[model samples]
Target: MRGTWLRSAWVMALSVLIVASLATVAAAEVTTIRWLYPGGEQPVSQQTWKSQIERFAKVHPEIKVEVIDVPWDLAHDRIVNMVMAGDGPDLIQMGSRWIPEFAEMGALMPLDQYFGKEKMSLYYPGLVKTVTYKGKLYALPRAYSTQALIYRTDLIKNPPKTWDEVVTISKKIQSEHPGMYGLGIGGANHVSTLSQYFTILYTYGGRVFDEQGRLQLDSPEAVAALKRYVDFYRKDKIVPNPLEYNREQLPELFSAGRIAMFVSGPWGGRALGLPPDNDRIPYASAPVPAGPAGTATELVSDSTGIWAGTRNLKAALTFLDFITSPEEQVQRDLIGGLVPQGPTMATRPEFTKNPFFKTFIDMAPHGVPQPQPALWEPFQEVIVNMVQSATLGMVTPEQAVKQAVQELRAKGLVPAEKK
Candidate 1:
């Protein structure tokens, strides 16, 4: 009887030990990664992104990803608040332009150790430049967008290659097609208006800041660029109600065939109710027209960065590598409607099959990154107000340039004149 009682007690104790060991193993196997993305709130966008995350989960069963979707308008401020509260996610989908601000704050991981300078060569030079601050790489680009001249192929037999051609073709189209404008223009106080104007400014050898980080709003190049853009509205008269429109209006008008030609990204093709393959579509794209200086356009990119505060840095980087792998990158682009980031993915059969993607691809090498100063938003506002003033006849382009310089100087963005 004594032996029987002892054996039963031993068996019960062994059972308890086994259960505790199994529970510990299960807990150790799971590593949850917090991910934040701007598109997580949109139904279609969220669904698509979640599907990709599910794919990652399948490949790495040990990792669990929790997603937080925030709206684009609120994402920056929200992230700042979260980081300040010491509760930021392990990974984030951030705008390339935002990288500079966030990285400067020391909130992002220096990714050179994970991604390396050698791998940086795989991406467009302009895109690589956008995520680098003070010689440190802070993020990995997932997708990119660049502006190009999107025109109705049935209307334009030959695409314009120069800004002068854009004017000539637009004027001819306006004369021939009643109620149809030649060029799509926007002057509303929106950031996109500034992006559209950047094409023209860059083509004319103008820059927002010189190499010395001094504001160049009143530079001769800047004055000329602004004057030429205003002429498209006040002088050419090909753009309809240029002062009253915003960015969204032009894409919609183009889709309805109300405009003959305009500049936009590949997303415009989708907005037109056309298939992804341009060969089957009635509209096609060309590089943004060249000016006296050279060809140029704005390169828009969204990147994924690991948070500097994450405890799961190794696993986070593994996840980053998985998402950016060539095969997965193509899958992500297909769902997101983004251009591929690197040559390996760009040259893939899947991407090359879509002809509209070709123009964006060609332009990527020659593209210019948007300015990424810590105070870039305020700087962008200066351009917005300047363009609005010039297009609305509130000020001449020369006067607009001078006023912009003054505003920037007062904001301490530009060097003040010595007393």
Candidate 2:
């Protein structure tokens, strides 16, 4: 009896100490948020974030969120300089490619600790992984994209499901309708071209590197991917002057009825359907076709993350949660023309019925993160050149892959394997 009573007292003492400690820690914390976003005069993202600022202020009145939407075009450089100077924002919006560079510099805070797996169940897993570094979640995607084939519904009564079908359809359509290429390759040198090429590369089981982290771009799968893309240029005779094609300009082509089907975003659907007060172009979208193994759809997204150097971490997190909450998310589709990110929000049956978004909504699960690597933006040009060389038939598919891998190694962008 005496021993039992002593043990009970000991347990009570420990519990009391833990509670007191937690209280003291809580008391020491401060509240305020500083967020930086790339600014533009008329971007939908800015408008949405601003409209909800007051509502956010109401919920966390104890915390002040200082929002800075910096000037357009130079905004990426500004954020980089800010971090270099130890003056980073408490929260920042990052492009998919930027995740790896920031993560490697230790400029981002891993959010997995605060919001555990159960909480993470709230978002698209593919998108969550995009900003994850070494299994730790670093950022949350606010808006996301999946590769989908946007088609002129009138042209493809039964949409093509294979590369061969696409070729046949393009030939038939173009032969019948001159000046209208069945498929438009917005072939200017940019992330869009590189990204489109990667979809094929991955579908063929090729990655930038092997499991050992050595350059594997010269592999059979890489050759296969490149060959398929090159055939579209050389044999298909569909894409006209790919070297001069600009993706941003391709939409205008689609709008003007110069192309039947092209790869674009859900926003394109809206733009196509409602050029000026619902002129309503007939259209539909679907997942990018399957490679032999499986289909891979790349998810391009912008994510919001807590900056590592912030003093007001708790306050910043509060804002993140608030901004991503259901209330703010309600306007997600209406405002941005972006698809839903969380299962709670994304799986709504009503959204699936919206014919324009159905195929894309079905494709959300198969999305891949834009490959995040430390200093990826700089090396992207080489990747584009490699594809351009192959498309123009300057080199064989295997040779192009080989040269790209060699350049990647020489640039030291790809990390050497740990022995």
Candidate 3:
């Protein structure tokens, strides 16, 4: 009986060894890729990404994806540091403006070879251009947004069509409603400050850089735009303390009935807890008020890119394709409160059926992409300071613009004037 028991134990040990070896082999066959995700730290955002990975895994079981969530503010420096250390994630979520800087650093893989023209055509041409650096595509657009004028329907029966009308309506609204501002403008030291200013700057036919790449912040158009934006706070006083607010805060203030109107993206409605049909706050969206030049809005996009240091290039590309697929993109857009990136997505009922989204979609053609500099932080800082200075009565709009232009020139951000 003892001999029989020993034989059974030996057989069990052999079976365990074989199973362990097979498991090892299977693990070796699977390619594990890491994705550094920015702005995914929120619970809902995390769950959505997890679900995406889970779906991707069911389709491509041989690959495993690991996501590292990072805050938006830290993502830029973190990515740069990791890439420089040769320890970057296999894939990264980046602001479209960062593509040029990363591509120039040779830290991102050129995606043109993997994505042919047909595939590239799936995205908006302007959005695609944002991820292209020197003829090479570096990433796929994931999130896109264009600003619009969000106003309280109860306060204004019709949206403002011109800048003069905007001010006029704002004055009327504030006069009727005490303790409530007619407009909410942002002048905080933040990126949204630049976005808000740029929207006006573009509407006034101002260009940060001319075709020759010369700085034009001090141009008459730019100066006029800035002056008008400041006048909303200083001269009209239709807006509250803009120096204390940013774009993100405006939606809340609007929802609380503190501001009657604000310029924001499609996400503004969602931020205010307004469903497609039933809105908690009675509001409507319209094209940004037109300037002398015409209506214009700031076009912003976030993208996903393959890291140059990744070992699992094939897996990374596969994941990128999977995540950027039309169905997946739509799901992500809906969950994130972002506008669709291309025509195909715009056609979806989720976007087309919604009036607010439809307004932003119509405005896409007039969208102007943010300026791409070698380093966006310094450039953004200069512009933000310029806006804050003007709004705070520190300087006239003209002087603020001139100082900003000189600062950019001193930093060598502006290209040399053509000989």
Model 3 is weakest, by summed lDDT over 10 consecutive residues, at 410-419
The global C-alpha lDDT for each of the candidates, from Candidate 1 onward, is 0.80, 0.74, 0.87
Best by TM-score: 3
Candidate 1 lDDT tens digits, 252-292: 87766677777877777766766633453378888889988
Which sections of candidate 1 miss by over 4 Å?
1-21, 210-212, 276-281, 414-419
Candidate 2's residue-wise lDDT over 163-257, tens digit each?
Answer: 67788889999999888888877557776887677777766777775433456676888889888888877887877666777565667778888
Candidate 2 is scored at a TM of: 0.85
Comparison by TM-score, 1 against 2, better one: 1
RMSD of each: 3.3, 11.0, 2.0
Pairs clashing within candidate 2: none
How many clashing pairs per prediction, in order?
Answer: 0, 0, 0
Better of 2 and 3 by lDDT: 3
TM-score of 1: 0.89
Question: Between candidates 1 and 3, which one is better according to TM-score?
Answer: 3
Best by lDDT: 3
- Positional deviation of 91 in candidate 2, in angstroms? 0.9
